[model samples]
Target chain A: MSSSANHAVSYPRFLVRLLSVATDGGLQFYAWMTFLTAIALVGANAWAHQVADGMVLTHMTDHVSWGLYIANFTFGVGLAAGGVMMVIPAYLYDDHAMHDVVIFGEILAIAAIVVCIGFVGVDIGRPDRIWHMIPGVGRFNWPMSMLTWDVLVLNGYLVLNLHIVGYLLYHRFTGRKPNKRWYMPFVMASIVWAISIHTVTAFLYAGLGGRPFWNSALLAPRFLASAFVSGPAFIVLLLLAMRWLSDLKIGAGPIRTLVSILRVTTVVNLFMLASEVFVEFYTGGSHTAAAQYLFFGLEGHNDLVPWMWTSIVFNVVAAGIFLTRKGIEDNRFLVAACVLTFMGVWIEKGMGLIIPGFIPSTLHEIVEYAPSLVEWKVTAGIWALGGLVLTVGVKCGVAVLSGHERLVKG
Target chain B: MSDSADGVSRRTLLKAAGATLGAAAFAQALAPLASWAEGMSSEDFLATHYKELDAEGLKTALKRIEEDTKKKTGVDVHVTADAPIPGVKFGYALNLSICIGCRKCAEACHEENNHDRKTNNSYIRVFEMDKGSIDFAKGTVDYAHPVPQPDKFYMPVQCQQCDNAPCVSVCPVEATWKEADGIVVVDYDWCIGCRYCEAACPYHARRFNWQAPEVPAKEINPDQGYLSNRLRPQGVMEKCHFCLHRTRKGKLPACLEACPTGARVFGNLLDPDSEIRWVLANKRVFVLKEELGTKPSFFYFFDE
Candidate 1:
């Protein structure tokens, strides 16, 4: 408001403000960041060991070539897609209160993308040769390979969300009303792009006709349904945290809208799950070997049976909570339902989905997979790194939106 | 840039110290990757894809590979990148009735292709199946009985070199492809080792180099092919290429030559009189997973 004549310094000062906000946190924040840094370093060490030795360190084999890394990568994509839930409500449905907290969801998307990329980077046998997929510089078999499509949609969604969040935050920091034209086009694109990111990820598996467990027409819709559930589940938690930690005046309306979205999505996700389970069990063919190994014991090997059942139970319980009046009226029950849904989807969409696709493999040889210690360490480290990114991003947004940090008229 | 009256504040000094220590620790954690990258020359790292390489570039790559192999294993292997012969399409057929579950073909492939000795890796997997059924689920590859067990039939599987190959289509980079002679080959250097091709193949034909191959200096196969049996780098995909190194040079495949019962046949499908063509004409042959529509060059038949 005071810098009408100094338009040139506005951008430079905005960058300074954005960069310096991380430094303004208190001792508690610094300790949290330090702890995350330590875990991230441990993960880096594990990854370096994996790189030096090769992918043999992972539990993956020629039979089960993808394991925990791909599982987490799939879940991370769903979480990233979850960001668009807020955008659809705030912009598409014209929910004015949701507009206030949409940036946090976008920030969460950015962090989830970082996690997805990290998992993929660690999963590949040749991380150094990743440049071979570059479009012009390398031979990228596009339009045919589902992996290439995943790479494109993931990176595109990341950029789309980044632009929307960046433009809005920069304007807020400069004390200017964001021109709708600047971010609205991107906001709309991100809604579609969000759906694409998860759809392409599902296609990456579903397109593999050899793995009959994943080769279903219902896979894409299930992915979208679960994404809507997990994304809103997470945003509610983020809003509750913001309410507790800061003075961001998040009203009850956004939470109510997100809960309503969850009400439909959680049931839809479970219904799809039921449909998938019914088809696999009732058919009882050679193609149902993976599903047999997943739901019940197959040839005395049932590694995923317990995990799959737990996920189903959690999803059903969470759905029960969301479908009830107490879920909306009681804060404690709401938090529990959110956590259960989040973890339930993590299991269902991750290990519950990816691992079974590899078990009883293409040749009908039942070679099972379980993540090793190094894999777990690397997975944890990536999550910590994501936590760091999300924390720093949200803190900066909170600082700017609260009018506590801005450009100084020197 | 926070400073107190007495030069620098204690808090600022502590923050700087913490930052430097954190940076040092992070570097230590990633030191292994730095050293691993240092072993690869810039030429190998930055080399263009094999198809994109000109004649001179191909020669340079072959020479560099030979030199690297010699330096690492003290073996002077001759690696060739022979082009496919014109008007020739390779086909392979195995007579299931005459085939014994001896695994000699798999052993020959392992030795000829310079596979990792520790894993005893081979492209050919011979499954011993029930007499009246072709169900692969009932077939066991780890059967330890004598050759041609009384009531069992042996069926060996390898890369089918499919006309509509799922592996070729699924590769994000064109690292693996179908060559002119109907042989599916992989350029190990160009493959990113995502193993998507391994998952896509219904035959389970593809194999990934999970670790650096450990063949002894003397045991290393002196004869190699850039697209076939050359010493593969760690962390890439490889599979049966019909022994293209020898086959392209008018020599028979190692597996075929090693077969004692003459159950294996390999020849140009375009040539009507070739043994493979005769097998296709005279025998009731079938390709696995015909429903998937992967038209395989490799076929299996029964004497009946």
Candidate 2:
């Protein structure tokens, strides 16, 4: 066990100190919080209407069972899994430059998981009866139902990460060295867990043999490849923003490593997408109607055509920029490249990935989906909630590390 | 982070108290909004699962639902939870040769199942396909012209009620399940409305109530079944239960009775001499998306 955890420390006092970190921030921090709070309130209000009005407010028709809510849930899971990239380098290889930022990745995971769970909360039609999924108390059908497995893994992952991040931060605050025994096994377990979270999410789609678009062997790998690209891109962008905001010394080493990971993953992600596209078009069978709807168009309805093409274009542009020497050397282009890759992967991994699976429904009817204003509001609300969580987590972590905050020796 | 002699500091105590008060205030503020929720009631929220409900619970459930229906829709519905008969495995078949695509069966289903009047949601979809082709994509549901167009043939699609039911396997809460008599049913009250079952169904058999379905009081089919065709909650999933309420009692399904051309066939598949068995034995019967291995009880055959 870590000496910090082994010590005679007061957890109640430690928690109180952590609470104080959230309340303490600058003018800019307050403004950011205000902006997020405003969005969250609007979303909360919209959610109220949705709950009162039923899912009718959303554009999900009889044919398309899922919509933007599920797509965002899928994307959030990917974002959460991306944090492990930082974990692998800092813990496995013991990269010194990565040490300061690894906790930030864990913080990001917490934020993303919060958003993921929130999206799920909003997506369901009956929020009150969610307890039916609770094991022991309800008929959970764990081994039989893939959704039950998903519930178990997601909650397990959240608690596991929270424990690791909390243990490390508390130790740092108390001015004690973290014992490897307390955290190393967890860090290693986390690496595997990170892979499982995304893989399990991919399996959620793939196991459904009914939907031809998602029933592919390539889905899990594609999910991982895209997750690596988007996850690191988000961290790099956040690190850059933090550097501009304060005297946080995030060196070029981690940034270079992130870009390197992005470049390779981007290429691999695009290749997998292309390979899937080739197979879908080459077959030209009835099952390929969903792929046809995504790439070209089905009948005269071409809603998703523009979005899919735009995502493909952005992927190419971002990949090209990342490959070039000047792109890496210039901060502006690097930032632009990261932003582009982030959006590209978001589109590819999100709406671009989920919505098409339902189009040209099982009965071969074209029922398109577009998120209504209420859905967008709730979506924005969840994101804002996530941003607020991340901001608070980062503030506490930064303060403890910088020695601006400390535990009382008494 | 320093602890006082008592344990926690004054500031920490105040902060905790303030947070609790803040939470209580938030809940109080949302109470009026909670009152605004129509159709959903405390009783509905506390309704137990179908599998766990005893005879007394089922009796109370039926009585409560009747009262709830009268209160919400101003329609008195007699909802019964009927058990399946032993030695009965229900099966359905449609004769593509005679189906005229008039969509009367679809209409009958909407009324019988208390489906939304506004959306005209039905358990059945009639696809008008080219006479020479069975490609469902090429089939148009909105041909608009008089159906039985000389160039086209009609196929009405609904839940296959698969023996190896994917919909049953995917329901996170076990809200949907296959009955002992081979018909699949959904306990509307227990569903979380995740819609994963809808996605798993290859036939697009399941329907989700995106809104509180409106049915005129006079048009409402007062006779209903708890698991088969009672008015579903706004956020749950519903589908054809082979009209098990009627079928288990030796009555014909709404769709089979509504068929003007006598195309729909249904029977106890376990009975060796049944008409459905005859169709399976003599006709070149086939099921849609057979590669999915759902083992659908519903079959389609051509007599032409």
Name the candidate that leads on DockQ: 1
Q: For all candidates, what are the clash counts?
A: 0, 0
Per-prediction TM-score:
0.97, 0.95
For model 1, residues B1-304, the per-residue Cα lDDT tens digits are: 3446564466656667888999999999999998789779998788788888899999998999999999999899898999999999999999998999799999999999999999999999999999998988898888886778888999899999999999999999999999999999999999999898998998989999989889999898989999999998889999999999999999999999999999999999999989999999999999998988899999999897
Q: Residue by residue across A264-298, what tens digits does model 1's lDDT show? A: 99999999998998998898888888888988968
The global C-alpha lDDT for each of the candidates, from Candidate 1 onward, is: 0.90, 0.86
Error of 2 at A109 (Å): 0.5
Once fitted onto the true fold, the runs of candidate 2 whose alpha carbons sit more than 4 angstroms away are A1-9, A408-410, B1-33, B36-39
In terms of docking quality, how is candidate 2 classified? Answer: medium
Per residue, candidate 2 scores C-alpha lDDT tens digits across B113-183 of 88899998999988999878888878878879876789899989999999899889888889999999998
Best by lDDT: 1
